[model samples]
Target: MVSIKKGSLYIVATPIGHLQDLSPRAQSILREVDFIAAEDTRHSRHLLNHFGITTPLQSLHEHNERFKSPVLLQRLHDGESMALISDAGTPLISDPGGFLIQAAHAMQLNIIAIPGPSALISALSVAGFSADRFVFEGFLPAKSGARQQRLKKLLEESRTLVFYEAPHRIFDCLNDLVQIFGEKREAVLVKELTKVFETVYRDTLSGLFDWLNARAERQKGEFVIVVQGAQFDNKAIDPKTERIFWLLRQELSLKKAAKLASEITGVSKNTLYQFALDSKNV
Candidate 1:
């Protein structure tokens, strides 16, 4: 029998899609915990039913987590162990229950993490990009303007970029990526990961966009977009060129400054613009 200590909070990772992906330890913890706190009781019940695990569940989503954290913490203090789970994948990764975990730490309560399936890690493993270093942006802003601004901020990121997108906004997100990152930038779109209809499309930004449009069903699943970082030789800009570029940027807009600096120094305008963006000198 798996021994679950009392007065401890177990952070369990549920399967993102496939039910079998839930580890034996996670199942044991879930079955043995006093009760489970889930983002959605109904959704989690289904998973529990499949495994024949009859452990009771309580709701702890974004809207009510603030109010419920104390209540759950008190239960822990009363010697009741609990497991926290999101609707899918790991809890608190683009999901709720962060406040509860933080409170647990502050209260000096025991917290254990049972790691399992994560969409971010699953997508990155097969992305074939630089896995050594990467950034997980989670979900971007819903509105186009805010989303574009966020992408613009990461325009010069050299490490791989990972993001999650809903089915409805996948098209617009990919469009903005193409516009900001350029058509030829390499990217991978992993959809409905670990499920029967899983699809992994790898190509340039424009090519991925076209590939999605070519098949309507391709756009109808949870999406994980992995983008290759900007390829630029920062050392290519000599001190003389950088000095002139900074001086021009102060006097004119980024476009005009990059153009004038490029013409004067014989450096690429794109490189100058990227430099300005990275240094925030523009």
Candidate 2:
């Protein structure tokens, strides 16, 4: 039972990649609002201009969001309804303005959402991975060691894993993922989604890394990585691991077989070694 104020703050969504995806409701709201708070004035200018939306615009991004929150809150308090939009997609999602929204809520001011496109949702739509359960990891650590450690943490995750990466960091990031998650893990790489030169590639982790490395041009756009969920089984070990252990046992000692299996499967070598010893005892 939320009351609608005559001059409410409207949180609108713009297009993530395609300008045409901008909803008519979003366009109308942009045109009708007393003012609009945008993440990037220049980027939003192009969008507003394309639709002939001439509403007064104000900047509200990471650099100035803190100082501007109070001012925007004051405007809303004064019964001046405005619309908040990001350079692309919805606001407060890897964008700024979380504090301002909370402030508005506290004041009991009318708040509304004009939904449209989101990059995360857009990428997931074409990823072709299991969507029943997924985790949206906005961005990875910029450093090498930290990033690899994070990927290692998700090695056993049973749900699909999604991540956003900048163009400059894509190659190195993918390299680290292959090292941590194993070369055979399946992954889908979606780039510049919905925009020209958009590409969706589904392949093994090593293959995607090789493809990106071979083509310098392929590394220029924003990227989304969707990794297949881990398969779970219990019969002492997975079929894949059991087969590897069996093959290695034929040529190597029990300790060496476990080490080889652990390296190949990214499992614990000690655990595999104990299993191998138990099998020998049997």
Candidate 3:
């Protein structure tokens, strides 16, 4: 029996996919709270009913969060405990609840966390990239131009990058990524995590793009993309390798040229790729 804290605003994390992934503490918190602020009441009602919890639910999504924050805060001030939950996974992670959480902070109420499943953390765990430092860019812009521009700015970032993507735009997103990030850049696509049809694919940008377009079924699921950040080694490249890079660039894209040149010279592709860019500017 978990003790429900009075006047506390619990930020509970629910299951991302698997029902059993919801922690016992999270279930207890939801059931014990005076009410739950859900991203979607209809969707959340089903989840609560599944767990045999009949906690009252009120809608609190991006559209109405700002307006409803004050009302919910007042309830908390009245010594009523509340739990904030998203449609799935952790609250405020590419989801709503920021306004309510912020209002609670202003009132100096208890803000508790009941952590559980998270798609971002789950994807990183199996991405095989350097997870020590990472950046989570929840969802890319819907437009092609904006998405490309956003990716371009992060081209030089040395930490792993994570993104959540919609199923319908997954292919288009990959196309833009390949264009800006280079086909030789390594990336991982995690789909339907914790679900029965879950898949984790690791490949170069081009390879993953090809594989995704090769089959229509692969494109139908929630996606989390983990991309390796720019990497460069300190070993100075000899003139021969530099010459090889130029030779390849004559017929290949900068990234492709760097990949081939590095293969021949045993130099770092990112280092050679950066050199290609610098040389092009000069």
Work out how many backbone clashes candidate 1 has.
0
TM-score (all chains, Cα) for each model: 0.85, 0.80, 0.84
In order, the Cα lDDT scores of the candidates are: 0.93, 0.85, 0.90
Q: How accurate is candidate 1 locally (lDDT)?
A: 0.93
Candidate 3, backbone clash total: 0
For residues 71-107, write the lDDT of model 2, one tens digit per residue: 8888888888799999877788778989888888888
Q: Write the per-residue lDDT of candidate 1 for residues 1-282, one digit (tens) a residue.
A: 489999999999999999999999999999999999999999999999999999989999999999999999999999999999999998999999889988999999999999999999999999999898899999999999999999998887777999999999999999999888889999999999999999888999999999998988888999999999878887999999999988987889899998999999998887888777678655
Best-matching candidate per TM-score? 1
lDDT of 1 at 99: 92
Model 3 misplacement above 4 A: 236-282
